[model samples]
Each structure stands twice: as structure tokens, then as C-alpha cells.
Target: MKFTTAIATAILASAAMAAPERGLASRVKARAAAARGSRPLEAAQKPADTTNKTNVQYSSNWSGAVLENPPSASATYTAVTGTFTVPEPTGSGSGSSSASAWVGIDGDTYSDAILQTGVDFTVTDGEASFDAWYEWLPDYAYDFSGIDIAAGDEIVAIVESYSSSSGIAIIENKSNGQKVSKKLSAPDSSSHLGGINAEWIVEDFEENGSLVDLVDFGTVTFTGAEAKAANGESVGVSGATVIDIAQGSQVVTDVTIDGDSEVTVRYV
Candidate 1:
């Protein structure tokens, strides 16, 4: 979602009023950069069987697990939730290195839209920062103010869609007992939710129309991962497709699903 000058100015002004301690420009930058939701796997990348028991896929921008509805299936996902400890990002080179962990519905098999919420971890010049935010694709992510998030905080991310055009994104800082939420709607008809996929993902999000440098986010394990179908049946990560991030020919992430309700992503 490209932000116009007016929109950017409005966001900055509100952010300044909401979070005066964090600089206005940095908050706007983080929110704008966080809007790039999960993208389809690059054509060159394909699903492959790993030496382990699970099937693995490769994507340029995403790592974790995605549960997809079969083409012939009647049930659709309406809610997705996951809990994880925020990983402390370590900066390597210059500039800034960043990563985000989020739980969402759609954007895999149904690529038109995504309803997601998570925490972004970044390290710039050896100083680390964390922000909790929510997004509906085709619009810029909005940072959640009034909540203090830190590395090692346990976070619960959730997205629930009541219809194709409406949903809610919620973030709970379990370690601090603070919560924030937003009622989301499709920005346009093209971005409506289809309820085709539910995911727990660590993403190298986009900024200025390009992907930012991925940081070393140690390892993030999403526990209590669950998705509820429109039929009211709940499911976990078992039988979900595993995805690892690959930059060119070099794979940078290792993803594994443990039992039914846990999925882990490790920076490699």
C-alpha cells in the first residue's frame, strides 16, 4: 500500500500524539514497512521433500507453516491464533536489519488479501526496537500505541474474519499483560478475504517497494497455534505445508512443525 503525502502526514501526527517517546518518523517508517504481507513463493522455488518426515517448500519472503483448504473442500478458515516469544534481533551489517512474526488468514492459496497481526523486531546500529502492529493487505499497517513491547516478551497474535470484508486483528503482550486490537475491513473489493489459508509466519517484509535486510532473529517457535474453520471446527499445524526462506539459491531459514500445535522457524 503506497502512502500518499497526506496519509503519511496524518499517520505521523497521530503517532506523535499516541507515542511521544518514540520518534514520529521512526514509527511511521516501521508501520509503512510492515504492510508488505506474505507473498507467493517465487516461481523458481518449489516444494521438496526434506530428509525429515515433513514436506518443505521454499519462498523468497516467508518461513513457517501454512494450512490450506483443498480445492474440493467446503470448509474455510475464519480465525487463526498463535503464541510466540519475541526473538531478539541481532544486527549484522550496517543500516538496519529486521524481521516480523505474524499469524494470519489467507495470502497463500488466496493471494488477494491477508488479515494479520504481529510484532516487528529490528536492530539498527546495534540498538534494538520492537513494535506491535496489525494489517489488512492493500492498506498500510498501523502501529499499536500505548503498549510497551520488549524482546523476550510472549505475544499472542490473532485474526478473525466474520465475513469477506470484515475482521479483527489483535495482539496481546502476554509478558506485560497489555493488549491492542483493531477492527479491519477490506480496503477494496480486490482485497477481500477468501479464507483459503491459515499461517504462522516470520516474514522479511517490504519497504520502499523492496525487501529490507533480514536480521538474525535467533529462533521463534509459535505454540498453541490453532485455526477455526467457518464450520466451527478447529485445526492445528499438523499436515500443514512447511516453508523456508531462500534468498537466491541460499536458504536462510529452517522451519519445522512439532506435533500439532507448534511450529518453529530458525534463522540459518
Candidate 2:
């Protein structure tokens, strides 16, 4: 997950946003502080040092399943697609249970930055809502306002990095044929989005400097998921590795890349 010249790390250092109930920016900033060891938290609360690998927060993180590719210098990624049921979080504890499923370029196999988009499913106080969003890391994720994303909606999420810092994100509610597409620009070239990495993931983003508890999402499957490299090479999950998020020594979830581009994430 580590790439040469950690330019992207600069971008990742600023990408998180707080949950809706948590005064967004401040919460994200708090988490960032904790990630850098700026805050005093319990020894068991800190995420491990994954300086060169794909870093995952022991608190809020991409905690479900992930399939990631290695960095490529001349790669121009395009057309990453996936379909999944928007899961209702099983918030059995004191905090909300939330998770996000998305596809993007960078983050894993690169530095701190990423150009991505997907759907966020949240269950707060026993109520569930699914929303679609797109993000250029170092920036907050923006929800597609007019699009209605509901639970069990067959969704198709796509990200095409047309240029080094330019891309388009599309989210479609396949069941209703309602979709939204947005053009995005990464904040800086440090993103090194081109020829970096591509990922299909389920993440548990942090809020208020703590990792949010993950919901029992059961299983999430990413289908027809593939990327196109700058060299015109079709990228699949052939050599992709399974990424899991853990707390202490206990691995929490599992990911598997099957065949060429099908990926399944199961909650344990």
C-alpha cells in the first residue's frame, strides 16, 4: 500500500469530515489530531503506524472490506463500477453504526490523498439513511443533493480519473434509474492521482477524534469493478490484496477479490 515519494500523504492529512451530528469540521480535525498522536487517548485506542502501507484508523476507518492495486506511474484510471445493497447499520452499542462503500483512485498504494466517490450508509438512533457522495481528498465529501439513495437500492458507483487532477464521479440508483454525476478537481498535484492506486472499499470514518463503531452490514459485494491504466491496460483484481481493519490483534472484517473484478466484503 506504500508508494514512492509520499506526496499524497499531505493530501490525506486533511480529508476527514465529522458525522452530521458532530459539528463536522471540528470533529474531523479532532480525529486528524489523534491520528498524528497529538491527543492523549488510551494506548489501545490509537491506530497502528501504517506509514508506508494503506493506513486505517483503529477508530473510524474503512473497516469492512477492500481490494486495492499497487501504484503505477503511467496509469490513467477510468470506469470503476460496483453494485451493492445499502446496508442498515446495526448500531447495537452507545454510538452510531456507520459504514461507507466506495471506489476511488489513490489512498491505498499512494500517499494520504485519494480521488473517490460512493454511498454512505448510516444508522443513527435506530434510523437509517443512505446518501451518495463524491470527494477529492483534503476536502470534505459532498452529498449529491438531488439524488435519493435509499436502502436496498441497487447502486452503481463510478469514478473515472480523466487527468492527473481531474475526474468525474457518478452514482446511480439502478432500481430507479436516478443518477448524479459530478466533476471534481484534486486540491494539489501532491495527490499524484495518476498512476497511483485504485480501491473498492468499505470504511468507518472517524468523528470527534474517535472511531465510530461499525454496523453489522452483513456482506457487501462489488461487481464489475475494474480500472483502466494509462497504458491502456485493463486492471482487475487479479493481483489485488485483501485489506482488513483491526483493533489490537483481532481482525474485525474480511475482504476477498474473486475472479477478475468481483470483490466481496464480509463483516465478522
Candidate 2: C-alpha lDDT? 0.64
lDDT (tens digit, per residue) of candidate 2 on 74-190: 445555666777765665534556677888776654555677788867676676667677777766666676777777788888888777778899888888889899998877766
Question: Considering only N, C-alpha and C atoms within 3 Å, which residue pairs clash in candidate 2?
Answer: 8-112, 9-112, 12-112, 59-211, 60-211, 61-204, 62-203, 76-230
- The deviation in Å at residue 135 for candidate 2 is 0.6
The candidate that achieves the highest TM-score relative to the unseen native structure: 1
Clashing pairs in 1: none
Residue-level lDDT of model 1, residues 58-127, one tens digit each, is 7788899999783335678899999999998898655777899999988887888889989888887777
Q: What are the runs in model 2 whose C-alpha is more than 4 Å off?
A: 1-60, 63-72
